[model samples]
Target: MFKHAHFKAHTALFLQATGLTGGPGAAPLFSGLDLQIPTGLTAVTGDEGTGKTSLLRLLSGDLSAHSGTRPATDALWLNLALPEHDEATPEQVWSALQQQCPRWSTELQQDVTEALSLQVHLGKKLFMLSTGSRRKVGLVALLASGATLTCLDQPYVSLDQGSIQVVRGFLNDMADHPTRAWLVADYEADPDLDWSSCITLG
Candidate 1:
């Protein structure tokens, strides 16, 4: 398991949302949705039209909910596929994240980079890499961020079989962590993972 000495103290409740709705004008995705997120591996599963990504954004404080108590936490949600990062290389992104994330782990970053076979792509720009490779870059940063709460949207999507296993292994190792939570939003929870909580939307 990845080791970080300073663990941020938290209540049993890592995150709480009450009566949460998507947006102002949009139809309510789930009305009066109450959730208590604890520290551990959490799987948010739902159909295509469901608000998985929106819920993650709300948790990460990237977007405001229509109406609810969705308090923000020290969260990390990296969407590196944006146009602004197209010209940036993985090495550049890693350097930037290291400066931004106070608890960043260089050891974890190096280990994950090797496990995912991403060393070769670090020098290439984001646009020059394939979809899976780009996602791996984001995964590397996310895993090493050591944020209080880490939100991963469709983490396994577009990943190669080997890389997928690497990601899964890391999450499995984090399943019983004392602090820090990882919220993975996907279509369905992987049966192999020991999820502490599972939220189903749709």
Candidate 2:
């Protein structure tokens, strides 16, 4: 459980689309969409093929909108999908995050890594680790990042019950942050989570 604190109002992300289209002959996902992500937690929920993932990718600048323009969001952090790195060890990935992500915090990294019980698999290569372990590595980096906006796509996937609980707590803790905004996109909403706002996409 997270400590309840005063909620502050701040806008960390703004998205607008006059007409956005992609996939299968450029079908439009959403048109005239406007979203303002303020400080706190927001949940994006919808069924599969509803463009929940696509919206996150657009926000993260991983996918381009066919029509609208999004402002530069260098401070945004998202962990939607991880590319296969067969030869990379969890330890190696951790080291790379230290150098690549400017907002990476050592203290936060240690806390998340321990909470996720990722130490046991740090020495193992990506190919050798279980799906849960691999996700933990990415989860650590995502939590350690001190970005203004953090988007997590299906974060609970492949996680065991214990790890899922840990991540829920971590996300709750992050939701209390004054400057950071947490956005989650999933097939269904976690009933345990206290979302400040929710958008159902289709």
Candidate 3:
């Protein structure tokens, strides 16, 4: 049996009519929408151009809401939409991070890298890495970080079937430990996703 979690104690993710595009008369993505996030997985599913990614960005505070409330976030943002820097090698990226704020445990880094099967081309430059590899590296890095909330945008885009399953498992693990709240934006729903809540935009 899965352990019960205290939803009240978990950090909340709020969403209110978040606007994506900018400029005069820039229309809001989904206006007057309210989402109260507590725990477990919450999927923002919709058709293409329905502003699902914008919702994730708003939740992560990368994009600001136009005229409504957004849940308070105490975590860092991870942009899956942004590609890795072209000039940095994966190893160089890791090395650079070590010189800054993060000092990831060597064992955890190795485990995460292997879990994503990224050991094969640690020497490869970011510009040459496949789309899937970039996603894996960023997602895995977020998974290994200290952030308590994860907002992933169209995470299934280039993921293999096995990799998708791994991500699902990782989400489950995060919830089981009550470590973070996952806000996943995807086109289709996975059967195994035990969502505590789901927010949809039409």
Candidate 4:
């Protein structure tokens, strides 16, 4: 069993930005933004093209902000939609992820796999699965990672209602832990989520 640490090492993420602009000559997507996301579930909501994706990218260090500082995180996981490898099956990719991710949890992996009903798709190649199945595989990876801060972009993209319910249940359960944080940016709000905080961009 994973012990929930009562004391948070630091805030989940903090960004002090004068603005988040695109490339040179491009207008700022969002300006004068500052946030201190705490250790719990946070929902980033806003209209499209409002820098929601940019904000998440900056937090995960996948994209740099024009004038902002993203604090260091001890363990961070960013949701990635992997490309289809002709020969790679879901099982192979999952095995590879387990080997590469330092915070990977076997117990959590099993739990998510079962919760999402992913066993049927495990042996199928990434290209063979439906969109929802592929997304579920990625969800399993993100949930099982056990990172201190996990950033998920559009987690409910292709999920069915049943699978979405399972995800919501898992998130509700994970919220009990005092140390880990989940940052989700999506266009639509999940009515069932009990968010620690909700931020709107633009």
Candidate 5:
């Protein structure tokens, strides 16, 4: 868990998207969409084909918009269940991320690692870990990255109940953070969370 005093204080919009529209085909998943994302927790909820992941990708600059404006910003979108480094051990991945993320927090990483019971698997290659464990690895990176805008796609997919609770507890602590934004895309918003905003798609 993060101490409230560890967070920096800043008042600024994390991201803004206007007239956004893009998808796999000629028919876009969503059109003329606008969003004003601010610091704190936000939820993107929708059914299977409702473009939840697509919106996150567009916002994170992982996918180009068909017609809209989303200014560049420091952001991260890591698919928790399937990271790219299949051959690297969690320890290696953590070390690489620490070098890459200018604001990475070693304390948060250690806390999350222990909270998720990930210490035992750090030396094993990612491919050797179970799906839930792999997701836990991604969770550690995501939380510790300390990016201004952190996007999580279906974060709870393969997590066990205890791990799920841990993730939720972390998010709960982050809900009122003053300088960072966390956008969670899932089927429905967790009723227990105090979301700063909730965007529901078709």
Candidate 6:
């Protein structure tokens, strides 16, 4: 649930000497690398095809690293691509997650739903929402899950300014409120968030 960074800073996450292989027994994406991601907003940036998404997957515990160790973080993972199909509304998303994850409380679910302003979207269909709305839904689910760690890949992709603001605002709120550790990977991170720590890939 917790680990330490190289500087002795308390970290909830650790990716140590980790390696990743692409495709069926292909070359490694990352090898023999060690890293510690804090429990806040952290950004990762790289050029197209730089395995940024792959890295996010590793953090979410969805993909296993070929070698090395990642911090043992009790985290909730949300993959923006190929979203799951739920016949329920966005409001229902939180409730559903709560039901699915017994660790979540009623108060926590309500807090996330209300904070994300997802109250009105309860009756709407997941497919009916705009591109931005879909991404917002993903964000709401991640923030409210109380998983202690959040790893999002390309959340702002294919969204309008309003949707982007919605996402950015949520991230900003996380920073101010300072809850769990969050890692966001985007084409270009916002300067306002002090996310320059993002590892740059060739």
Best by TM-score: 1
**Per lDDT, what order, best first?**
1, 5, 2, 4, 3, 6
Q: Report, for every candidate in turn, its global Cα lDDT versus the true structure.
A: 0.83, 0.70, 0.63, 0.69, 0.82, 0.62
For residues 107-141, write the lDDT of model 2, one tens digit per residue: 98888888888888877788787877887887887
Candidate 1 residue-wise lDDT, 1-202, digit = tens = 1111222243255777777766424676556667788878888888886778877887777766777787767898889889999999998999998897999999999999999999998889999999899999999999999898999999999998998899999998988787778889998889988777878777
Error of 3 at 10 (Å): 11
Q: Which stretches of candidate 5 lie over 4 Å from their true place?
A: 1-13, 24-27, 80-84
Instruction: Show model 1 residue runs off by greater than 4 Å.
Output: 1-11, 24-30
For candidate 3, the 10 contiguous residues with the lowest summed lDDT are 15-24
Query: Which residue pairs collide in model 4, if any?
Result: none
Candidate ranking (TM-score, best to worst): 1, 5, 2, 4, 3, 6
Clashing residue pairs in candidate 2 are: none
| Cα error, candidate 1, residue 83 (Å) | 1.3
Better TM-score candidate (1, 6): 1
In Å, residue 48's CA in model 3 sits off its true spot by 0.4
Model 6 misplaced regions, further than 4 Å: 1-27, 80-88, 99-120, 176-179
Winner on TM-score (3 vs 6): 3
Judged by whole-model lDDT over C-alpha atoms, candidate 1 comes out at 0.83
Candidate 4 regions exceeding 4 Å error are 1-32, 74-87
Residue 153 Cα positional deviation in candidate 3, in Å, after optimal superposition:
1.3
Instruction: For residues 30-110, write the lDDT of model 4, one tens digit per residue.
Output: 444556666677787778876677777666666656665556664444443456454577677768777766888889888
Task: Provide the global lDDT of candidate 6 against the true structure.
Answer: 0.62
Q: Give the TM-score of candidate 1.
A: 0.88
- By lDDT, the best candidate is 1
Clashes of each: 0, 0, 1, 0, 0, 5
